[model samples]
Target: MKTGSTYLQFLAAAALAGQVVSAETIAQINGNKYLSPYNGKNVTNVNGLVTAKGPSGIWIRSTAPDSDERSSESVYVFDRNFGKNLTVGDVIQLNGTVTEYRSSKAYVYLTEIINPKLVQKISSGSAATPRVIGKDTLSPPNKAFSALDNGDVFGVPNNVSLISVSNPTLVPRNYGMDFWESLSGELVTVKSAHALTKPNNYGDTWVVGDWKVTGLNSRGGLTTVDKDANPEAIIIGSPLDGSKNPAITRVGDTLGDITGIVSYSFGYYTILPLTALNVVKAIEPRLPPPTTLISSGDCSGLTVGSYNVENLWAGSAHLVNISDHIVNYLRSPNLIFVQEIQDNNGETNDAVVTANLTLTTLTSAISSIGGPEYEFVEIDPVDDKDGGAPGGNIRQAYLYNPDILQLRKPNFGASTEANEVLPGPELKYNPGRIDPQNPAWTASRKPLVAEFETLDGKNSFFTINVHFGSKGGSSSIEGDARPPVNGGVEDRQEQMELTANFVADILAEDKNANIIVAGDFNEFAFVEPLENFLAISNLRDMDEAANIPQLERYTYLFDMNSQELDHMYISQALKPKAQYEHVHINTWVTLAEQISDHDPSVAKLNVCKK
Candidate 1:
């Protein structure tokens, strides 16, 4: 046939030109290692089948696979102007220099070839079969990231180091990051992938294919069981075919089979799909169960709630919605610890520290919703010293139903001064700030401790509401540090130590002191600071006391993981009969419906008995 004759003539013409045809393949250039040995060297007459193309270049796969798991059989050819002309399935020969591209400040390095000296379109319509995953291909390793991410522990001080400085050899099976790096630029297919995280503004999501996964919650996403909760998961990026991905996705949405090239971006291993993804099946979100018992201030017990209102000022929005959540979801507890209550003027920076308007507005909203007329008490912070929304003098406060538990008033102290815990029946002030003048309290919200007596006038309990220093100033999770520096961790530790010392002082006076420490500690329950608090006189986290599943205990969503930032730790005396309910009124819902970043939680403690 004429086609066969033409192919023979083409081969003859190539032999006469001495062009060194069929010299190398893409696999040779991409060895099973972090850095390429052929890097900075000129590669000549590399033949490949173009599987996909983008604005920057084309991803070419080896027509003759090397069949090596350690080496990638595909590579990216950088020829922006000429790449746009190439079509999928086109067999091409490229001559270029291989280079490792570091995307940004992140330490990940992507191996790619650039500045093609020759881009010969040998033939069109070549077969480009994507390597099907979850069928016969190798599954992702079950545990740890590469040595680069340091194994089993990423955020500990002992393992922190830079990959660039070490350039450690790749151990693809040991770590998720290294596994994806080994397959970089390779065209692969992930069959039946389920979304592990909700789509962000960019329509990017983390997903796991048909493979075994650890910490698989009932909702399908991985949770914090140990540390490496998401070993089989990878992020899916925007499609290169110029189509929008699906909207209204949740954690358990079935994102069907995804065929794409492996990539690294924004400190995560990613996949660039060839086409936009369509949801195969959607699972309705499982809402949290309502609190069992509503509080009516019976002498039998006291119910307490804690929440960060997210900068609630006098004229701020979401006032009604927040109050609604409190009344309906939180069940209108007897005493509620609230944080981020702004000054009367909101974020005006006018040096006014009082939040009478803000508190009154919220209380009025609660009463309007058929809830009790709760009275609030707080010691306002100095101008903007506490870190939060600028000019919004955010501080902690207590809102209690007068009919349930009355505040035991004590001699008030100056707002700037600290209120020491006296021996019995009285704090320096009834609802007063603790250690406000301590250097540890500088630029942070001081713990608000208050003494309350049951309406029956029998027993009294002390509660310390605190919002510790946030994780600002922490290094990037993908930075060179192994256990990335948790910014403001030391400050938060000192804050917890100071609060614990105050509780210790109270216990010294009364050995069986009924005390509760509750608020946004801004650290994980397993973190060192909280561990230090647990060692203090047997204070137990309500999560453990209430027997909530470790994977199901989360009050805030940050990055890819659901974490518990807001917590309530009860004294040893209250742990036996205490029942805590995490009202998931905010975190799992859509961002637009969120009144605050944190979900409010209620705990019923037998303060009267214990």
Candidate 2:
């Protein structure tokens, strides 16, 4: 009999010999978890078939795939030079170290083999066919984004933990992220793909295929209904064969079929196509008819509108288009709450802090189009104090038809002066900033409060125009962080609290005050900040009051979902007779026809009913 130490050494040597004799398959290298089990380990003689070759490297698929649905049969090899001698349908074996790669912490890692060396080309001339995503292969799950998100991807206190660290097993049939992760590096084809958004600057287009999807609007684009963000959609990135993608594609346009390699880049899972995709069916260039909620032309009814003009300057070329949208599509509401009105000099940091010229130019354009000759009121922000494009000094303003509405008390306050509600349910300053010195408004636009009345001064109501802090610094929805970070949420919450308190003071003075709070809140209605604001202020969202269908209530389109960023809220007094419509002038048109990223909205209310 041998000693115990000698016996252990013999067992270790036997195991090492077994490892040297066995070759790893692609499925074995990619385990069921988010991270590979063999990460950071050097392996020899990995066998696969060369599926596709691009400028970066080649994709290889296992000849003998396992029955595990969670394990991908293909993977990318990151070697810029090694793929030059390779071609599709060549069976090969390679030696490399398994690595998990991501450009930053905000993105999920792509399982890859780096520093690869081709050991053998086993065979060539075999057929390389891509698996059809929704037909022959498994379809992407439609409901949830990630199981790691605890049922709500937009919940607060985000970035609490990372999916990378947890490395949970994938549930490919339920979660969207898991479904895509299961096919990480596979060659797949999307059939009858329809564009979900306009192509980005890099020519990447978001699209949903013939697969079953939820929240599909009548316009052939997906909308955010309830908790679903439409995870069945995927983005089509640049072509691997180095061709230019169509730049003028619009939402609802069709790209017939796409065959590409599934990969992750720029915080989203994308398909790098084999060649450029052309628009097989182009959408019509006509815009939807103007809103039906026209002005009542008297104190019996009030027609109000809200739009974020996207940093309008006095001499911007798109002024005519924007004026046309406001006149024809929005029906030229009696009062319009507009945001992003830049200074007269337009983005010059020379201490010129007035927007009179910009507002006049827009009003003149509207009048020239046979629309209302609107009068405007605003408090110019301190030079460069507001956060937007640097030196832009964007602020919120009111554009009202003087024949229908007028300022109740024409006392405009200075930029930094805080407005207060007095005993008469009136603002101390007619058009004033709301709590400008508060930390919540730091580097953000302050709320503009103005008291309005019918031309006869018989019925009075209050309006607050707000452009809250933006959603900058937010993490990607498909990022590693669970319940991804919503940047500026805390500040938005504080800002909402202050605005609600101001509303409370008005209610405290007169419980039946007719107040209409509207503008770009910069947060979704279902999110925490807006929810808290609605809860505290007792303001009703006009969309609900108007009974707009759940699928049609959107004013902006981004990524894979058509969502609402501009909103109009009403006090309890105006909720009884509010009617609203979202004019889809921008969202339904091609990117070249869009004057602003946001679509304008119109609402008709009976402010004098009570």
Candidate 3:
């Protein structure tokens, strides 16, 4: 080991000014002034020694990369609002003062780091000066590499995953304690323990033995307040020749090694010093994509658009409702989802309901626009006795251009609230709708799902459409609100949530699977039901592309006022493939008398490989 008066001076000078350090503390720690305290004045300038962390959110940067830039500044964030604006590959530094925070571990905190840059150079007398070390260089240690990937700990092999010991018992009882005590004030390599398969919030790479040393130099004392029940670390410096365990010795000009059993489990793994690590270098664990069905459409990368076609329901016996709204979605659906289809009896979709052709009627209409290649998937028709509003007891349904997408496995299931108990004769005979938990009445108009092979015959996700209970306010306006499905706005909210939860349950089955939920929810974009849906599920609303401007946002108009009631939520699994985005909101009336109370929404989606 190299000795230090001049070496210590160089490092200390580089630390932020105002920092308080004991005369003996090393000077060259992370000294960027922009660190926490957000205070315009630099407190670290005075104190040479300030507490920091083992390193998770650590940062390093060029002190002054430009004339306008200060000698020290870094980026850090504790605020949620600002975090939302951040994007991938953004290079930033912290600025706030150091403060304790609960993360994977509870270690030291340095806030307010900013002015991100790499590779800084130093000018004479300038904080810009580089930290210097005089230790004689050595060659890297040569040992077979080992990688650890058990549920308990994982890392790249060789450098960061090595462990010193695995003994169930120790001689001094906790002899490791004595080792640590002897190695205080020494420079040691430590892996952040929190990265282990199991780690506490306090990040610390479990201790490996001290760096093996030969031709021993003096090992200093460490005065750490180790409140931890079992502390583990690797000491770098040494009073090591005397220890009962094997000692490491420098053999190469830049590397060192110790003779010990290579762990069948952990040695050969790479272990790094937290303060000296880079985040981008950290690899996040992942699950292989689903193996069942596959989606080959690059639709996520194409100009994709989505919209809700208002009120296409089965009404009065033979009059199946069909709207001009859905005419545009025929031949090009990577996947299409829509809502609001009413039915009579168990007959639904295009089946004969109340002599009214619902799915069958609309299927004809959609085929007119999309050509014969179009088809549909829907929930079993339900009997809504106590006539619900406009679309009757409309729930959800869809029309699709099958040529673009084929399903791997479409989990078509019912919603979660099926009791069909509105009030009066209008709903007296009406049956309830989807409620996943109630297997007793799965036939209710629930989400319709069908997996298909694209015309090219590749895999894809099935789309579900919904027109949740409208804002009938405190009671079902058309008929007196019944007991079960009638808690007023609360019930409507609850039902939608049930639907969302039901869908989430499916996604949870395999988070990597791609899914999309679309239709006229009848609730505002920011309403609780929609918000909760987004929260619990790994899905994001594509509405934002149009939501930025109110005019661009308004889709379904009621009484002539525009509101963002229609929606399209896509799974995060497909986020990386999303390429095109558009919303064609047809809210105006043509010479032909307008069909329904709501407008039709349309989107063209594209997914592609980079």
Q: What's each prediction's TM-score? A: 0.90, 0.95, 0.39
Query: Against the correct fold, how does model 1 do in TM-score?
Result: 0.90
**Could you tell me the TM-score of candidate 2?**
0.95
- What is the C-alpha lDDT profile of model 2 across 268-288, one tens digit per residue? 888999998889998775577
Q: Considering TM-score, where higher is better, how would the candidates rank from best to worst?
A: 2, 1, 3
Q: Write the per-residue lDDT of candidate 3 for residues 1-610, one digit (tens) a residue.
A: 1124574343234334434322111112222221222322222321211111121222222333322211222222223233233332233333322321212111112233221122212222222112111111111121111111121111111122212222111111122222221211122233221111111122212223233312111111111111111123232211112222112111111122222110101111122221222122222212111112123444442222244434444443322223333333222444456555555433243433332356666566556665334455555444452224422545454455555644433443433344221221111111224453443222223544333334453334535456555554322101111110112334445556666665576575656555566676666555455667677765777655334333345444331123456677767665553432222223322212334444444443333221
**Model 1 spans > 4 angstroms off:** 1-23, 148-155, 285-287, 475-479
- Candidate 2 has an lDDT of 0.87
- Candidate 2: stretches off by over 4 Å: 1-23
User: Tens-digit lDDT track for model 1 on 402-458?
Assistant: 888887664555677777877673588767787787787778899888888787777
- Give the candidate number with the greatest TM-score: 2
Q: For residue 110, what is the lDDT in candidate 3? A: 23
> lDDT scores for all predictions?
0.77, 0.87, 0.33
Cα lDDT for residue 533, candidate 1: 73
> On a 0 to 100 scale, what is the lDDT of residue 381 in model 2?
92
RMSD of 1: 6.9
